[model samples]
Target: MSVQNRTPSWPGEQLCNSCFYTAMRTHGVCPRCGHDGVLPGRANRTDPKPVCLTCASIPEDYRCRTCAAEGQIYRGGRCARCALRDDLTALIVDGAADPATMSTIVEILCGVERPESILTWKRSPKVRSLLSSLSSGEIPLSHDGLDAVSQRTQEVSHLRSLFEHHGLLPHRDEYLARFESWLTAKLDTIAQPAIRAPVEQFATWHHLRRLRGNSTPGHASERSMLSAKQQVTASDRDDQIPHLAARHPPSHRS
Candidate 1:
């Protein structure tokens, strides 16, 4: 989580060195100084209990104001986890145009094992933009609707997974669907009718046909779809099309 704006983890919490060690340190009523705070070390060799850091000649206080929990203070004396929950809840309620539509996201985000990690993700510009689109109904809360927002592929895929996991969206072959959309857009980019026509025919009759045939009841494997897409994309290239024509040249027989 950023000091300015807490967000996602690549794999774990992005805590600073101090905060990490401090969080792991013991905190309780000090036996020596009788002060309720972070425990430092024994006052003497024979001491039976731990003492406050100050009594042991070390001094630092990291306590939550609201919960009295000992940890890294996030904001207004609250711990990072607590602050994360509050922030996420506020964002969901305030940003969502329709609270009912966003209920699943809110529930999942709030109940994460590490709110700090999610907070880090929320701080991302792409994530914020996606959330804005979702909140304003710019992107409909459906699989096909999400398919239309194609640019942010990674973020969209993550959101799709979350929605599917929570039963908000029905599971489908996301890779196949993405390839179909990509093919349409890719074909549209070809201005030459000759090139476009041949490319479209090849994509539809060759790659897509085989892919559809191979797909089982559940979603097709990502590897299979990726291979098909690569072949179709390769065929769309100017040089590759000439080769395609050479291999499958039109026959004129008597």
Candidate 2:
């Protein structure tokens, strides 16, 4: 049973850093003089957590917004793990990051002095893909994945700087088109000639060519294996005349 359920008419009260107290007030506002503009919870993490309205400590309602968004823990207010601590909290009103890996990513972003530079960097295909994967929960916390993300972040930053120098930045579509063209050219370069041809037909062609070159008259062993019952028309013999003449030289050199 909850406090509201236990006491039907009891005014709603929240967990306080001082003690269990009840008072009518708006969000982040308390009757206590010391708790001006302070809410009823503590920050267990860098995100946000139930904190004492007075001292901004915990044991109150709500979890850290950051950890919830990242799907991590709900310990307290902002910690070291959050990547976009302010940005995420502002956007989702919430937002750990994998410390070792994400810290590296943060360092990459930190190198960008301009805000627009960061925004433009996100337009890159590799960076966009990485963020999309993270949002969709497709990314794993493996070292390789984090390393790729870190590397792309630096690359995106460089690209953004280069674009800004020219005049303006390109959109995601432009980046995507260029990537697709590059990928296609690379694939074509590495592709085998037989890749587009039908396997069975190509194999048959190869076998016929091999037979034409290897079938000669000198080997009596292979000649004995020829089908005795087969009917050979004049056209077949005509085909053999050139080969037969080549195998045996004329009595006198022509």
Candidate 3:
């Protein structure tokens, strides 16, 4: 039997997105297809339309912010903050940074008021050992680890004060230029393989934004630098060693 498609005449009933069937039942999977129901489209309806947690709007294209995977949009882009936090934790576990340092970084990023205490705690010898491991390439980097770097550096007391004084507004052009130059230097010194992916991802996201006209020339330049850095690093690898021209012919290789 064909299902009847009818418009509801009741005061509070509304139609579903998939099917035109109207009902007063506000909750539960659809009776016909067992799929989730769309929110009722009514002015007085109290139920809010499902929205992403981070951006607070229904995601047009659902994609996880962390893993960049599909089918994980229910929790607002895969819990961006949690994913970031976990990544940082992994970096700490791998000895990228001392636990104290990591804690200080987290406190700053999470907007903790007592950042001084955490910073002091991170200055211990035990914490210094972990940081040494990170410096010596004994431990790998992670996405969260890179985020911690960004957050910690951005939160320098003086810089934070300056930002607050400037109304906490984003100086996109200025920041873009500085970030580009800074990252170029970092790529030369950074040896951790695990952190590279996230750093590149961060750069790409900025590049896309700049391309879309949401950013400025400085931003574009910064992205260009980052892209170039990634290419240079890849070319320098033994597996994909770059071709070098010889001044003399092959016969000279006696």
Candidate 4:
């Protein structure tokens, strides 16, 4: 009865987004339940020719105008994927960056499990900011470029992980990168080279090297990587010396 929070599934009825998606995902007779179909708004459950909402549609307007595919229409009579691709192309090609150079990003985002999800994510201000920088060439399309962004750590990390996952960027240990960056900043605060060098050596050799050795290439878990950072941080604070010494014997000491 309440269509305010629902989607138009039939002429006079509206379904929630999820239900609308499910209802519109297929048309014609449903293979799973052998239910005969009817026009989207012309049948009822009690009718002699009952309509299966799961496989019903408006024959004249239920398809994507661009691709002629069935499913939930996004805008311009295009499906969500088509619309997402168009929007991404527009956003990503908004600057000096060549359209050809942004094809991969567009393709990757379009190929997500649900194009609708990317469309939703694109609405975030932070996401738009990152994309704007990328489009304008302020941020190079490289790990180093993402690395140089000292602000928006969470957003950068998320986008970097997405890029790495999609093979758009070379795969590397994300946590390891964070630790190395943390170590650099941590060392810069120590004016005395004597103190800084040993701390760096201890962190790199004692914790980082071992973390790398134990890592499964680009597949290191966040917990394991964070644990390594915690170890390095603990070493810096000298809060747990015995543990550090136990791990770093004289023969293998930093």
Candidate 5:
């Protein structure tokens, strides 16, 4: 397939001029899948080098290489054996089954599959479990634990309506741009060092939450920390996301 998401993106404005190109050119080498794994000279995740295409596309690769590769089929790094181990660990974290028994289960899963893609992820234990779960209703899409959450159709319609109500662009692309512009304006209000919080929000949240002994929050827990020690209305959150991010700026650990 063509390079679906191999193009690079801006990690932050701090990368002025040549520094931007340099990071991409240098960091393109993916340590996991290694030289054969990355799309050399392609950019994504602000790294100009050959990179693990998926994480960078999920925009997920920006974290520590090890963590980002966890449970994932590293598109452009590592070998089959290590990727299997990573997927096994990820499945355990996602709670596919008990970690003690997962290796055997994954072995079974892998044994039944025939290779169908160059990436070899079609035979991944993680993929097998996810597919089997979906087929058998062992885990519904809405159920908890490591599911790939997607925006529902209603949610999309709601966003479109909101865009219309705001007299903003109604097209998805235009609406997205408008929303990003608004978010950028909000982030710009923050003082130095954390203005890029919007771009790095997921990684930042996970890092901070892990510090509080909360490693992985479910979708609900993630979207909002529902049961706050003190009640803060939605309005309060709207006003505070940027300011709060500034005081305790999160880092790009990878």
Candidate 6:
């Protein structure tokens, strides 16, 4: 009788469905692949380095260690190259990346996913070039960081539009209320010297300027009218005293 070779099915012989590298043995886990829990065959390849998903050309080691991504990487691990590409699309509806990298930083910031990306991009050569061009006034702000500034301006415009639609155009009480809440939260961090002064200064200046501009000609006229009436009353009182003296006559006139 010829004996047929049979594959043994053990308690831990399960394989990952995605990558067939790691085998689930007695521990029911593929030591070779950490992702066997999700997919049975998923395995980590022995490749020295992996390639970034967005930019397959770049080595994985060159990408962000956290997200395994690279280039102008955002908080969510977006690659800088991808961000610059997106920004270029946003800035030039025609899809031109003139001045090459200026708009790149702006676009990344305009659709900013991670706050940390701002600092990272700032330190990047592309961002430095953009800033240098801006400082020298060589590049127009409209064309330079236009995307980022435009995004903020657009947001404000959008909010204004929504407010107008809801009959809240002139009514900023809700916005003020929200602003106050935000201010309170920010002020609560007063212990941090870096944050306190600038926030307070800006808030103070904004409120003061707004209040100063809020007075209308009609309100000013009303105030003036009230002042004039008060002056007339004072004059009338003075005349009354003279009249009373004449009426009483100089009782002791002798």
Which of the numbered candidates is closest to the native, going by highest TM-score? 4
Candidates sorted by lDDT, best first: 1, 4, 3, 5, 6, 2
User: After aligning candidate 2 to the native by TM-score, how far in Å is the CA of 46 from where it should be?
Assistant: 49
TM-score of structure candidate 2: 0.21
What C-alpha lDDT values do all the predictions have? 0.68, 0.35, 0.40, 0.67, 0.38, 0.37
Candidate 5 residue-wise lDDT at 211: 29
Deviating ranges (above 4 Å) for candidate 5: 1-77, 108-254
Locate the minimum summed-lDDT window of 10 residues in model 3.
241-250
State the lDDT at 230 in candidate 3. Answer: 60
Extract clashing residue pairs from model 3.
none
Q: How many angstroms is residue 97 displaced in model 1 relative to the true structure, after the best TM-score fit?
A: 2.7
TM-score, cand. 5? 0.19
TM-score of each: 0.62, 0.21, 0.21, 0.74, 0.19, 0.19
Candidate 2: what lDDT? 0.35
Cα lDDT of model 4 by residue, 2-65, tens digit? 1121365465556577765555544566444565442233355454343454544434355677
Which digits, one per residue and each the tens of the lDDT, describe model 2 over residues 61-134?
33335543211121344212343344322222223333343433444453444333454455467766664454
Query: lDDT per residue, candidate 6, 80-151, as tens digits?
Result: 435444444443323333444444334434444443444454545654554555434454444223333332
Query: Residue 202 CA error for candidate 3 (Å)?
Result: 45
Model 2 bad stretches (over 4 Å): 1-85, 88-97, 119-129, 132-254
lDDT of 4: 0.67
